[model samples]
Target: MTTLLTPDELEAALRTIGAERYHNLHPFHKALHGGRLTRGQIQAWALNRYYYQASIPAKDATLLARLPTPELRREWRRRLIDHDGTEPGTGGVARWLKLTEGLGLDTAYVQSLDGLLPGTRFAVDAYVHFVRDKSVLEAIASSLTELFSPTIISERVSGMLRNYSFITEETLAYFAPRLTQAPQDSAFALAYVKEHARTVEQQQAVINALKFKCGVLWSMLDELDYAYVAPGHIPPGSFRPQDDR
Candidate 1:
């Protein structure tokens, strides 16, 4: 039987998962931050990533409904508010549209998700389903990816601003609030996982949940890289960087 890990040990294990498998290590991100992609490639990225951003609240809502306590529900609901906002034309999703618009993508087109890559849709949907169906412990642990996000967000904001003149601070405003929000969210998730995952089976499940979440993120980039970078096999009907109309 697997041994149970101490809370500190489990936290360390989760961090190690982020270090090794997170999308920050993806070549697409390296190319993005290195300013190696064309404006159209960046446009495709913003357009595709918008789907992930837009789905966050729905995913959180699924988990929110499953929380057994008022405190847990209250804490989880903060994510919905952060992403969906107090009203429309605000919050993280709105800020993401601002990015797409700044990238010259039509807001309606991006929101319509008309040309989103098949892989992007599948990967993101899997996340929503995971939260909805997994044990609440696994569901919360999946969000532990946010623990590593602040660093990547900082890297992306600085790198994009410095390398891509077309990208302004306003264009990347989506990440600014996330700098604070992600840490707060991840801290809560990590603590919850550490507190609740007391047995060997539960601890391993928590670790696997983090790994699964990382795969979701990494696969999204894998599709982007395949379609836009090497081999350049963009699936039919998907947004084409060359067609930037």
Candidate 2:
């Protein structure tokens, strides 16, 4: 028989899942933060990651659109604003471009996503589907990855700065705001899960939701590592770094 845990216990289990499975611990990230990747590898990482960043506001909006309450919609709209920005050539996507541009990739190619990995597309699209198809609680729980993002962001920023002469503070501007925003967003989502997940079943669902999301992120990196680093198989019609050969 399966064991049911208290809300506090479930929260601890979720945190443990993150500690164990989150992408921060992935070898690719270790290579990235440890300055082991080449410029081409870094560029490949950024280009592939753009898809994830671009999809965030849309996923958030999809969840917001399903929200029945004006208060919830109003709260979620800020995430859209944060990613979409108030004007042209701003916000997270644009800032991500800055990183790509700093790395010498053409903005058009990166934005056009001409070189995206098949696995990257599949994993991110699954996230969108999860938000659309799942309950509001599960949708919100999927974003609990944000709870662990700040740590990765901090390591990436500091390590990249020290390691890559081509990288600049401006290139990393996207992560700066997220440092504060992620915690604020995750705290609310966590508290909501704890409060609303009154039943053992609901609580278990929330835990599963988080684990599923962690898998989503992990799968993305695994794709990148396989396609770009290990097997080095650049799939047909995907972006190929100049030095890939």
Candidate 3:
């Protein structure tokens, strides 16, 4: 925007962006949650998503290093801990592996990222690079998507549980913590952006940062839908869901 917005107005604008651009609105997400996706499609989703989950601590650590104060650093540190946990076999990333294993994917294969779609790698890497390279304001702004995540988590957990027999609550445990974590994380980010992004240029940059993150997420799903949902476009060497049989 060319004009300076009040904090509430800026928050409204950010929420408006979420309402319009969040990946929860993506067609692939719709199918996945609505039970329209096949086992293979779901496997591909879980497999590709592992890359994003695994990279989150790296993303948070980049931004955490840039924070100016102990408070900010401590706040962001919780994110690192959240994803990495105090030790192995704990944290969000490990929980995500459990999810992939629940989908019958081998833990080593998911960790190796051997079958990751190029699109997944590109989009997720772009997100990390964005955090590493951008202004701290923009970096913080990108995380505003967390504001909208809880609702989608609710939809996803409920829908998947009801529709898919293979997907039990235990399999989806990763999301349980995220329902609370996302709101807390986004509340901090939302306040930070509203307070820090005071000028027109800064405000617009924040808006654009959120839009960029949304695009990153949306693009990942787009690749999944194109490669898996739309028929035979799975890229060469990407995971081929039980083709051995």
RMSD of each: 1.4, 1.6, 1.4
- Reference-based lDDT, residue 67, model 3: 86
Give the Cα RMSD of candidate 2. Answer: 1.6
TM-score of 3: 0.98
Model 1 misplaced regions, further than 4 Å:
243-245
Cα deviation of 124 in candidate 1 (Å)? 0.3
Local distance difference test, candidate 3:
0.93
TM-score, one value per model = 0.97, 0.96, 0.98
How would you encode candidate 1's per-residue C-alpha lDDT over 76-101 as one tens digit per residue? 99999999889878999999999999
lDDT of 2 by residue, 1-245 (tens): 15777778878988998998899989888988898888888889999999999999889989999998888888788888889999998788788888889888999888887899989899999999999999999998888998899999999999999998778898888899999988988998888887787777787788889989999889988888887885588789988889631
How much does candidate 1 score in TM-score? 0.97
lDDT scores of the candidates, listed in order? 0.93, 0.87, 0.93
Q: How high is the lDDT of residue 219 in model 2?
A: 92
Q: What's the candidate order when arranged by decreasing lDDT?
A: 3, 1, 2
- Please state the error at residue 241 of candidate 3 in Å: 1.0
Off by over 4 Å in 2: 1-4, 243-245
The lDDT, on a scale of 0 to 1, for candidate 2 is 0.87
